[model samples]
Target: MTEGVDPRELSDEDLFRELQHLHETRTDTLLHGSDDALERHTSRTQELEEEYLRRYPERDVDPDRLRSGARRRG
Candidate 1:
């Protein structure tokens, strides 16, 4: 926690900073042979990002299409 910054209140820049810190911490913990949780989380995150890219080929999608596609069932 940095000063009085609530995570929900943080701007995107602040949130990204926190995310970078978390990534470093997780990487360090993994390298040190910590629990399997970090590995599972990283794998899942990558898988979901890849899947999203695959399902939505457009790099810049229309908002309506994005929302409608997201709402559709698999």
Candidate 2:
């Protein structure tokens, strides 16, 4: 079993740091990690991201990322 801290238990700064690190390594993990490692990474990412959304329900949305923005660009 991979013992780990719950994302909810982390302070905001620590949570953000963990999330950042995971995201930074995502592509490499996807391409190079073993199946179990990739699975663990995916599960951990979900835990952290879900916690982040729960913490900030009204998180900012960038207009440039909206569907309308993509339409305009096209």
Candidate 3:
């Protein structure tokens, strides 16, 4: 897990990489870690996600479309 650096301070590419790393850590915790570990990962993932969305609102995903399996026309 990355430490010390603030997500909001990261460059776009770095932030996305951090987000990807968090997702992977969360998945790993869910599969093999203690409940506490999973919870921490979940919380951190949410925090990073919120920051990412705040920084790049255009990249935000629509919850409704996500649930309905709809794709953006681009």
Clashing pairs for predicted structure model 2, backbone only: none
Please, what are the lDDT tens digits per residue for candidate 1 over residues 16-49? 5655665666666677744576665466445444
Candidate 3 on 1-74: residue-level lDDT in tens? 55447767878898788789877676678899998778777777777788887977897576656735554433
lDDT of 1 at 27: 66
Which scores greater on lDDT, model 1 or model 3?
Answer: 3
> Which numbered prediction scores highest in lDDT against the true structure?
2
Alpha-carbon runs more than 4 Å astray in model 2: none
Q: What lDDT would candidate 1 get against the real structure?
A: 0.56
Relative to the true structure, candidate 2 has a C-alpha RMSD (angstroms) of 1.0
Model 2: worst 10 consecutive residues (lDDT sum): 1-10
> In candidate 2, what are the lDDT values of residues 43-73, reduced to their tens digit?
9999999999999999999987999989999
Report how far off residue 31 is in candidate 2 (Å).
1.1
